[model samples]
Target: MIEALIVGAGVSGLSCGIRLREAGIAAQIWARDMPARSTSSVAAAVWYPYKAYPEHLVIGWARTTYDELMVLRHDPASGIHVRNGHEIFPWQVDEPWWSGAVPSYRRITPAELPAGYRDGYVFEAPVIEMPIYLDYLRQRFEALGGTIEPRTLASLDQALGASDLVVHCSGLGARLLAADSTVFPIRGQIVRVTQVALDTFVLDDYGPSGMAYIVPRSSDCILGGTADEGMEDMAPDLSTAEAIQARCRALEPRLGAAVVLEHKVGLRPGRPTVRLEREQLAGGKLLIHNYGHGGAGVTLSWGCAADVARLIAQA
Candidate 1:
């Protein structure tokens, strides 16, 4: 039997741990932080493929993840909700490249467009409550006989002695762990607020404010955000949070009175493209790289994990 050691306890690593255990492989996760404290916890977590590349692979992975999330949505405790939403544009545009991945995707009529938007698409996508969802995933992974230890690795080589395989899901830590210079941070800031009687999400990727989105969950709503490339500060900015609320309120007036809950900042692991390939270590152990998911980490989690399991099985 092969045992796998996975790095990172974010969505990607947890998802991979579950898949590997399901595939009859013993898996353990070691990470610098637990799921609740990882960067994934800061995501607004709507199921749209954002900031991931190589269109063909991203579409496939996104579609697969969509299917998985749809299944999980059936369980009330999963923190997954399939909600109606709009992705409005400031100018007339064709359907999105990821339109096919969504089962309920359709161009909204001009009458449905919000003020100041010329085109939009309405779709039903999963809006994940990251806090609850991460807890759910942690429980599910542990239920499957997998364990997650809080440990930080100085390099990929540190885990090779304990397992036949090391699966790298380190996200931005890949820059140092995998020695991949292409991995950089796409800084994002979001403000969480009390649910403002808003059930539907509103996304304005090309709006005047730039990349604003409203993701409503079971309890609260997540309003976000900024995509400042190469920005690395994890500290939440007061002005940025104010700007985010202002942009979200412009989209949905009800948010104007929404009570503020908390503010968060996360560094999305941006890369030219997601790295999901295998490598041979010096001692005949296998190393699988599975990082640099950018903003689509949750959107691509299960799909990438399934592929990672396949690679280990074949090896």
Candidate 2:
């Protein structure tokens, strides 16, 4: 049986497994920890990916995956559902910016907002409880006979010898293995709060030219801070955590003093461009590199994975 080894069990890695399985290929997803421990899993897991990537393949993949996810939204086991969402902008984005994918995205009237808020927009989209969603993906992968093993791999030689073909979804791990210095870590911290009142997701157009959003999943709402180009540190910094809270509070003064469910941080893998190319290693090992997603792993997974799969097939 043809087999592939996928490093980093994040969205891209699992998507690679899914596509390969559908194509009648045998694959396994290997990671240092559980797949959910990946940096992509830290994502708020909102569906619409603004400024994530412009790659034609990546964009198409996101749309395909999101469409498929929409189907499973009604299934309680799926961990996905459509909720009314909001994006509060201090100013309007260009008309072309709307692209009509933001589900009824429009400026809110003064009557619709609480006092002190100028304007906002509303839309309908899928929100991901990533903890649950990752579990769902793992079940599907395992059911398909895709094996997952946790091993700390330090070199490409280790990966080259492990499987017939390797899909490097290693995210930041690609830097050392792929010898890709262009890929670096973009740190992000978030404070999760239990806000039952936060029924909808709020996309905030603020925080360093607008990279932050308050996402309400099942049990907790996530407030984010994007600290790009930082060393990888999973532990949360109180200063950064406070800034995230302050930014989110501006979005919702109503949810005052919400309990801090948790505070977590992760480093997003960033490259000048998302690398989705395949190469033959020194030992004639098949290698398809698929990392550098930055903050859009969930958003770009299927699109990027499809392209990675095609690149392999063509080879």
Model 1 clash pairs are: none
What shift in Å separates residue 315 of candidate 1 from its native position after superposition? Answer: 1.4
Candidate with maximal TM-score: 1
TM-score of 2: 0.89
lDDT, candidate 2, 1-315, per-residue tens? 237888888878888888888777788877886777877678887886644555554556667767777787878986887887776655545443433444455666777664445667777778888888888878888888888888788886676687769888988888888888888888888888887577777776553434557787777788876656757777789987777777777667754677888888888888777888888766667889888887778767767777877888887
lDDT of each candidate versus the true structure: 0.91, 0.75
lDDT of 1 by residue, 202-253 (tens): 8888888777999998889999999999999989999989999888888898
Task: State each model's C-alpha RMSD to the native.
Answer: 1.2, 2.7
Quote each prediction's TM-score: 0.98, 0.89
Which candidate comes out best when scored by lDDT? 1
Residue 228: error of model 1 in Å?
0.6
Question: Native-vs-model 2 lDDT?
Answer: 0.75
